[model samples]
Target: MTVQFYINKFQALKPDKSSGHAKPHKVCLLLAVIEQIEQGFITTNKVIYNDNLKSRFTYYFEQLQQGNDKDTPYLPFYHLQTSGFWHLDVKPEYQEEFSALKAASNSNISRYVSFAYFDEELFDYLKSPATRHALKDALIHNLDSLEVQYQRWALSIGKSEKTVKNYVGALKGSISNWLYDAGISKENVLSIGSYAQYSVVASKALQIEEFRAKNTTGNGMYSAALKSYQSFLADVTQVNVKDDIDKILNDENTTATEKSTLVNTRIGQGAFRDKLIQYWQGCALTRYNKMQFLIASHIKPWASADDKERLDPNNGLLLLANIDKAFDLGYITFTEKGKIVISPYLDDYQVLGISKNMGVNLNQQHQDYLAYHREVTFKK
Candidate 1:
């Protein structure tokens, strides 16, 4: 009935562990439900088995599911009843069938269950952002163990124990200390709901007085730690972007014509995005380090580039959303020497966060791309 009680329940979900890693179905389902609630889909206590819910569930599944884990939303939908909070309302005529069922399948659940609802107290707790964040943090804390496994792997690959320890300690210590200063939990800052918060904390934590004092090796110590952490995150959290694109191209569900259109829309998703992320390490023009908020923008417009030029990392600039929009629409460009070149017509460039002081780092490889952008993409 209480928020802490539900948080405890979420943290202790009994997921299948026959596989080396716990199957992600139940947790992914919970995350999907929370997202739906946040997006106003689950307005009341009733939870419907709708397309939006299924789509979100599958999205999380793709992100979290590892070897041999199949996408089965129906399993969690029917089985979360055993968790003591999720209750299913089976139809009147199929009550006997629902009761007799040992396991659930999509077809049977569709036929027997009308909807699912949370226990009333639990539903009210979920509606509040703070409690929702707490619940999500509790669920995602499961990933902390995976970080341990990553450390072991790092050792196996000949990384020095001290080096690895400092890397881990730098990230964990800095973030936890920063959060404590901000009145959030001082411990387990690693599982703080989303990657955006983690990146933001890491950025702010770099400036903590204690950290600055100890970072006597210039930017080497903490910068190396942050990069290693980023690599670890990409390994555990992301699928190979190129492989994902190839799957879409090879899917039998889409015709060649449709595939062409789809591939164009997916231009930024391939190795280009990964390269930009690695190259910029953060936004090209700002201190914001949230990866999710950054856009991998091509300096030369994609439509104008040949195949070789389109995927080239040097042709890209990792930018914040507003900067990406302005650059894409030809309201802004940059000079060969990496200076900002705002279009004369864009009178309120300041409103778009485009300051006169803004510039990017450029090298010889970027010259051709910058020239093309200034000549063709710049408005004036």
Candidate 2:
């Protein structure tokens, strides 16, 4: 349970080598747990198999995955019990049934296990940054050696080391250009102050003419690299909001009129939409006076908001259907100055009638909600 004891355990993980390459699944899961701990998402030793942890595991899996390796986080979550430090807490009544099973499948694990946890000592050691770093480095050292071997193999096959180095730098350079184009400074999250900003920034970076012009390769290598990076980060950082309306609709005690009002507010069909219409006097972006063509969109997503934020006129925008969809999906956002900041990932903006010059009419009341949109909702 000491630091070195845990370090040795992490380094000596028994990954499947039947295919001649380590599966990387367990190591990736451990790395994801460490990341979640650092991010304050996994506060206690009990590891709930939630979307955040699953997404983080998938992120690391993508990073280290070799040929033919499939993403199956549930495998490690259950099988890690054999590794001594990890343990699974099963449902009380299902304990005997779970014990009788020889193999773990996703559905069975979900039904049987309440959560997983580490040994008390190991969990305490993981709370230390130095301990976490040492343990992670031990796990990653194997991956590093594999990369070195791959490089040597490439050289033996007549590919120069310089070509290999440039191939590696392609993704970094592409990502740098994306950050620059999105007005985010190198090494800083800028005004938004979160990784959530990367969602929209990655999107806008793809749309930048200079980015496309410089990074274009005949086979789409650079673009693919950018997308790969984007995908990994988005998976790690994106917040999954459960639909609040669904929960309310399922409550049998709730009255029909209340359900109707909530549903109407959600779809911009009720008083909330009426308020947005009156405030904007038309489309918030285009000032298009036609009322029927606009949708009332929440700046801070409905599921993540309270009742006040959900119905606040200042928290809403009356946008055209296309613009509403883009904004809802985080492909389009507005600056504090109200100018349009489109995601590079948004394809065919010209066809959709969206432009860089578009802006929304804003007041002081809207600033807080807009800030939430830029930080958490925007695709940057």
Candidate 3:
């Protein structure tokens, strides 16, 4: 089928607006998945409704969701099965949840569906750059005027980003901080980028009832945060990696394991391994280019990556086994600017052959995942 055929179908997702104009949450989610595929994040087409997909979808929803008309990823993903191009796989365990859904009018659909998928033909076609870009253009053009209005206004308002970011932290304060200091309350993916015109006042405060009343306009944390950084992100220029990548490739490091990973590309397999062949041919931090025994390790463990992230080449690195073990065990991290950071309390400092002066070669994507590794895995 023609790309326009798919684009038309994608832009026609149903909208249910009880209090205000409908928002295009489905279109946004689809766009997020498409973008993930183009960026080589999703290796498989199984669109599981997990935190990773939600976080990725949040990137698009922050532009469309408004006031209490929340954008729940499950709702859009679950309902997409009605569209011939999408499919929801109902597992045996979800039988009870499915029964409960049919009994209630507005029941949560995700409780009944374990995963989602796209028609193979449609998914394959969307993988093309020309096709993906065309559909993304069609979706972006579909946002309602009101949604566009918020996006525009959000861009113009200026406020303390730190204040908005610290809202949850500030609310929990010293008391709750100590009580559940390690509570596993899931972290919401927030847009901490910049925004435009904002209220610098203590005028009439907004109330829940007041804001929820039909046609009352308000911005949520997601929308506001996206607006703050939308412009900045759009204007960001990519850093060149040719020199850095070349240095690693030419380094004396040559190993059998890394070589195997490098050439293991078999009709869609080893995409990340291929990236190790391209961007980084040697250890990420350890200048040990002597690749006689290097490992192709995933920064965000392969077992944990969502659809697209697992195959992201930038997420993998070539490292000597010892350095890889140290990094894999949270003993070290890399700064966003490509500096090596060692854990504060590593045992047996004399051995391990790890040096603090190890040079690093990475691009923005590498830096991004490294930040995640540092936050959740690094010892310090």
Please tell me which predicted candidate would have the highest TM-score against the true structure. Answer: 1
Model 3 scores worst on lDDT over the 10 consecutive residues at: 196-205
Off by over 4 Å in 3: 93-100, 103-112, 150-380
- Could you tell me the TM-score of candidate 3? 0.42
**TM-scores for every predicted model:** 0.53, 0.45, 0.42
lDDT of 1 by residue, 280-368 (tens): 99999885787766777888876677656766889888887667767876777888788888777454567567788888888899999
What candidate 2 gets wrong by more than 4 Å, as runs, is 142-162, 165-380
TM-score of model 2 relative to the true fold? 0.45
Q: Which should have the higher lDDT, number 1 or number 2? A: 1
Please, what are the lDDT tens digits per residue for candidate 3 over residues 267-380?
112556446756766666655565434556778754445535655777777876556656766777788776778776454433566667765777777776887898988878
**Best to worst by TM-score, what's the order?**
1, 2, 3
Q: lDDT (CA) for every model shown?
A: 0.71, 0.69, 0.53
Give the clash count for each candidate: 0, 13, 19
lDDT, candidate 2, residue 144? 36
